[model samples]
Target: MTVIVREFQPADAAAAVRVRRAAAPYTVTTPASMVNEHRAAPPARRYLMLVAERDGEVVGYANAGLAYESSEPGQAFATPLVDPAHRGHGVGGALLGTAEEYLAGLGAREVYTWVLDAPECRAFAGARGYRPTRTLRYQRLDLASAALPEPPDVLPPGVELRTAADFAADPRPVYAADVEVTADEPTDIPFGPVDYEEWLADTWNDPLLDRELTAVVLVDGAVAAFSAAHTDGEGRYVSAMTGTLRAHRGRGLATLAKAESLRRARAAGCVEAYTSNDSENGPMLAINRRFGYEPCATEVRHVRTLG
Candidate 1:
């Protein structure tokens, strides 16, 4: 079998989505999301979406982009996913090779990729000069089986609950809150200030994002906690990001927003939901555990310094 790697075209949208879904089923994605990721990519990001074709069928894909949102420079990510059935055929290696060359050409000195925590998966990255950095988990919740905490009758003083849709005219406040919370998230590296315009283009306007299903907690009429929700055309919802501002920490607002979001999600016919967290994040993990979410899968973040 001959495998050829090439840039993705409009016609390859469905194939790309299929390859991604088959390779990583934890997140919900669509052809539109793939296209928008490229179209909305900033110049500094240098984003590229590539696919591997064998016998005229796409069996693998790689998404490479500079970490433009990070305060630091020369940071990039090239996440390559190959169909499990085609793992030994070198499709993954080829995809990584192309992704590295692209990122290097775009001025990236350090690249980070998430590899499954398995002997085979680790060896694949090791052979390519990647080193283990940290581990993250993909968690799942059976909305039908889990017993969620009851919603409080009334929020604490000066605290209110809302949704992302409530800030239709001006989402900058939400964007600011997101930037602050994301900066504090546990990671190998820190993300500095966020660009509101870029956040609006990539996150706020994402096609899969469901603002109505998203839950937000407001304190004194300002954004404090939020749980971003995503859904496929099917009945599955995922919590993309759930965080509370530092000032609101220890108040259980994160849990409040997440529980409300899950309740709204199930009421909207969503039967299952998913979320991910850094293995070292105890606070978030405890919040998730309280909601009966269990570990379903794990992926390790690997880093490689380019020479």
Candidate 2:
């Protein structure tokens, strides 16, 4: 096979989305989403989405960049996905190599990637100097079958539910709330405060983000909690990120937002919902459990420090 790894082109969006679906079935991806990612990537992150071509057909892709969201600089990530049918043909290895080289050129020292909890995936990362760090479980809920928790008839005083669309005119409040919640999320490495412009580009403006399906909870006229939702032109709903601000902790705001989001998703004809959580995030795991979400897949966060 003639293997060529190079920078991704807008024309390859369909092929890239296909490769992602083939490589990771649990994740929902679309061509439009791929295009949005490329256009919205911040320069400081040195973001590069690369594709592996074999005989003129894309067989794999890699998302590489510095972890600009991290307070600790020099952190980077390079996630490579190869079509299952084209695996073990050096496509993945080549993509990883190309991605690492590009990220290193952009001043990345430590690279992190998520390796699926499969023996082969572990071996592949280990062979490339990447070692297992922590595991995250991908939970799935059957919106068509599983019984979702009922939304409370009455939210606590001064609290009201809304959608991301409600803040379209001015989203800085949502941005501020996101920064606070993201800072408290469980992860292998700590992340810095959020960048509003970056958030607007990479997150708020993401094509897959369904503002209508995204449920938000406002307290005292302020964004308190939200369940950012995404869909891939299908019935699957993904909780891209769900969080509550510090001031709203222990108020069941997160649960309220997510529950309402899921309910809305079901009403919109969505048949399934998915979300991932770090193993150490007990509170989130418990909340997900309460939503009838079941562990469907797991992936381990791997790190490789290059000299």
Candidate 3:
């Protein structure tokens, strides 16, 4: 069987999303979200999405782009995922090879990817010169049945909880809090300051972002912590990001924000809630556990250096 790998098109959005969900069931994705991500990519990142078709049927896909937000240049990423039924048919290889060539042409010195923790997946990456760098855990919660914590009846002085929708008029404060919190996140590629315009285009306006479900904690009318929520409008929700500013750390502001977001998500008819965290991030992991999230799967970050 011949496998054809080509650039993704808007028409392929649904198929691509299906392949991704089949490959990583714990992750949340939608056709609209896929289209939005492709259309909103910044020019500098040179983002590209590739699809693998077998006899006119989409079987695999890859998302490749430079880490444009990193302080270090020449850092790129390519994540190739193949439907389980199509594995071992060269579909994944074709998609990944095409992605790597394209990224290298765009001057990527190092390419990173996430490989499932399964032995076959790890061996496939290892055989291709990729070395494991870090691990990430994907967690899931049964929002329909979990015993979620109740919010306090009396709010603390100067502390308030609000949804991201409240800031539709002005989101700069949310952006500021995001920047500060993201900077403290541990990652192999160090991130530089995020440009507000880029954040607005890529994140704030993303079609999948659920502003009503997103919860924000404000202290004295200033944003201190927030939980960004993404929903696929099909009973699937994911916590895109949840963090607290350094000054608000240890005050349980992030926990409060996330709990509120999850509660809102449940009330809005979301069934399953998913989130991911770096293996080294203990605080967030503990918080997720408190919310009855259980580890569903793991992926290891792998890196390959290019000449």
Candidate 4:
């Protein structure tokens, strides 16, 4: 069986989403989200989504792009995933090779990708010269069955809980909080200063982000913490990011935000909730566990240097 690798098109969105869902069940993705991501990619990212087809059926795909937000130049990323049913047929290799060639032509010096913790997945990456650098844990919460913690009926003095929707008129505060919290998250590549315009366009306006389900914690009218939520409109919700300002770290603000967000998601008809954290992010992981999120899968970030 010959696998043909080609650039992804709008018509391939559903097939691509299906392949991703089959390969990575713990993550939430939808056809619309896939198409929007491709259409809305920043030019600096040089993003390219490749689909691998076997006999006219898309069996795998790879998302390749430059890490434009990273301070380090020439850093790129390429994640190739093959449907389990189509594995061992060279689909993954073909997709990866095409992605690498494209990135190299764009002057990529190194490429990073996530490989499942399974033995076969690790072997495939290792054989291709990718070495593990960091581990990421994916967690899932059955929101429909979870006994989520109840928010206090009486609010703490000067504290308030609000949804992202409330900030529609002026989201700069949310944007500022995001910049502060994201800088503190653990990552191999250090992110450069975030551009407000870019953040507004790429994050705040993302098609998958459910502003109503995103909970924010305000301290004396200041954005202290927030939990960004994403939904597939199909009962699958994901915590895109949950963070607290440095001054509010130990006040349980992040937890409050996440709990409220989860509750909101459940109420909004979402049944499954998913989240991921860098293995080094103990605080967030502990918070997720407290929310009854169980470890569903793990993926290790692997890097391959290019000439």
Q: Which candidate is the best by TM-score?
A: 3
Model 3: runs farther than 4 Å from truth? none
Better of 1 and 3 by lDDT: 3
Candidate 1 residues 1-307, lDDT tens each?
9989999886787888888888878878888887877687777678888999889889999989888777678999999999888889989999999999999998898999999888999999999999999999999999866687778997789989899999889988889888888888888766777577888888999888999999999999999999999988688788999999988899889999999999888888888889999988899999998899888889999999999
- Candidate 4 lDDT, tens digit per residue, 1-307? 7899999999999999999999999988888888888887888999999999999999999999999999889999999999999999999999999999999999999999999999999999999999999999999999999999887898889999999999999999999999998999888788886788778878898888999999999999999999999999999999999999999889999999999999999999999999999999999999999989999999999999996
Count clashing residue pairs in model 1: 0
lDDT of 2 by residue, 1-307 (tens): 7899999989999999999988887788899999989999988888899999999999999999988877788899999999989989999999999988888887888999998899998999999999999999999998898787877777788999999999999989888988888887778778887678888998999998999999989999889899999988689889999999887889889999998899988898999899999999889999999989999899999999977
The alpha-carbon deviation from the true structure for residue 267 of candidate 4, after best TM-score superposition, in angstroms, is 1.1
Return the lDDT, model 1, position 301.
Answer: 94
Reference-based TM-score of each model: 0.97, 0.97, 0.99, 0.98
Q: Give per-model CA RMSD.
A: 1.2, 1.2, 0.8, 0.9
Give the deviation of candidate 2 from the true structure as CA RMSD: 1.2
Better of 1 and 3 by TM-score: 3
The regions of model 4 sitting more than 4 angstroms off are: none
- Per-residue alpha-carbon lDDT of model 3 for 1-307, expressed as tens digits? 9999999999999999999999999988899889989998988889999999999999999999999989899999999999999999999889889999999999999999999999999999998899999999999999999999998898789999999999999999999998998898879999887789989988999998999999999999999899999999999999999999888799999999999999999999999999999999999999999999999999999999986
Question: Quick one: ranking by lDDT, best first?
Answer: 3, 4, 2, 1
Q: Which is the better candidate, 1 or 4, if ranked by lDDT? A: 4
Query: Relative to the unseen true structure, what is the Cα RMSD of model 1?
Result: 1.2
Q: Is candidate 2 or candidate 4 better by TM-score?
A: 4
In terms of lDDT, the poorest run of 10 residues in model 4 is 192-201
- In candidate 3, which residue pairs clash? none
